[model samples]
Target: MKRKSSKVLWIDAPDIKARIEHLVEKASIDWVHTERIACVRSGNSSARAYARIWGLNQVWQQVLDVPSYYCIEVLSEKFDHLPEHHKDEILLHELAHIPRTFSGALTPHTRRGKGSFHDKLKQMIAAYARSFR
Candidate 1:
């Protein structure tokens, strides 16, 4: 029997990082705490991108040894194929998951309630639109 490798390849793509920086500035969100953005090829196809509190787990920290408030992972193939605006939208959506507190933690989406993920997405879109004006 063959064992499946759990290791993921993380690529530092400056172009993607630049886009994230522009989006953060335009969103007027204090994301200076974000330490890194990397492209990853996930086995799951439905996932476009995601953000999470980085280095919070001691065991994983010992292995990776990087300190960061947030780590955004863009699914390599799917994210790369998107248009610029779509990429921005997806990245913005992931960033919206971070709370205003700027702590190294994630604000999980409401599963089935008033303040659902969709609500947050709508608010993020509205804010992004206002940033241009």
Candidate 2:
């Protein structure tokens, strides 16, 4: 069944839950339901800086007492600028780590399909950025 899109007002204007849901759908997976998921700007990040460490094309999290999973944080900048499809791709990348999944998480130090999955996701972010610049 197709999931209906919902706008998350707590987050920035561009951070519609629909985009995240779209990503989940594209990956042929489902997002774990949580009551207080939030998408916000990185505390010390800005657009002027490179996106790899912190920018519109990146995201990070601070895990708390929840042992199985932590807070899933996406940069407001990166959350706003990606194309629809690529946004979905990024969502898939992040969602791949949801509980049980074979692909699991992509490690930077390891290679996949002749190239690192990390590099490929970076390429996706870069490509998404280049489309605007």
Candidate 3:
């Protein structure tokens, strides 16, 4: 019998990192520690999302004996083909996941108050637009 398998490759994405830095600055995402964040691209991944945020939780930080850090991952299959504006939106969405505390934890999509995650994301998109104009 033969088995099928998939391979995933992760590589540092300095270009994406640079883009994120610009977005962070333009959007005034003061809560995020841009320096501590890392960006990586994955090839041949099965994830359906355009991008995702991976965080090192407090426990992991303690276990690893390191400070808080975030990894923004872009799946090449989904993200690489997107338009520039779409890519920026996706990047901002991932950045939104990092809570204001910058404690290496993710903020949930559901909010306790009136607005939702999309609401915040929309504001960010608008801000990103207004930035360059």
Candidate 4:
């Protein structure tokens, strides 16, 4: 009998990194400029989302004695098949998870039971579009 392997491989994604930097600048996401962000693409992920943003939580930061950081990983299978504008929207949506504090904590879909994450994302996407004009 042959056994199946399910190893996921992650590789540095310079293109995604560039896009993120451009988005941050164009959308005027000032809080992101100060945070350390790493971008990567993964293969063989079974997750349903096109991309995911991972945070270096406070507990890990304290334990490792390191500064806060975030990782933007796009699932190659789904992400590569998407159109450019959709890719930008996906990235922008992931970026919306970072709170203004940039403290390595993720902002939920509904923030603090008051602010709506999608509202901010829509505004940012609009700002990103208007930047080029």
For all candidates in order, the CA lDDT equals 0.61, 0.41, 0.91, 0.92
Question: Residues 15-124, candidate 3, lDDT per residue (tens digit)?
Answer: 99999999999998888888999999998787779889999999999999999999999999999999998899899999988888899998889978746888788888
Looking at candidate 1, the ten consecutive residues that score lowest on lDDT are: 46-55
lDDT of 1 by residue, 1-133 (tens): 7555555556556676677788777767665444454433343434334322232444454567754345667777566677877778887777776666554456676755546777777777777789888
Task: Give the number of the best model, judged by lDDT.
Answer: 4
Q: After TM-score superposition, what is the CA distance of residue 108 in candidate 2 from its true location, in Å?
A: 7.7
What TM-score, computed on C-alpha atoms, does each candidate reach?
A: 0.65, 0.39, 0.92, 0.92
RMSD in Å for all candidates: 5.0, 12.7, 2.2, 2.5
Report the Cα lDDT for residue 44, model 4: 82
In terms of lDDT, model 3 sits at: 0.91
Clashing pairs in 2: 56-77, 56-78
Clash totals, every prediction: 0, 2, 0, 0
Tell me the deviation in Å of residue 38 in model 1.
6.5
- Candidate 3 residues lying further than 4 Å off, grouped into runs, are 1-3
Report the lDDT of model 3 for residue 123. Answer: 85
Tens-digit lDDT track of model 2 for 45-119: 343421221111113222233322223455555554767665555564554333332222233435446556565
Write candidate 4's Cα lDDT for 1-133 as tens digits: 7446799899999999999998999999998953499999999887888999999999999999998899999999999999999999999999999988988999989757677889999999999999989
**Candidate 1 residue pairs in backbone clash:** none
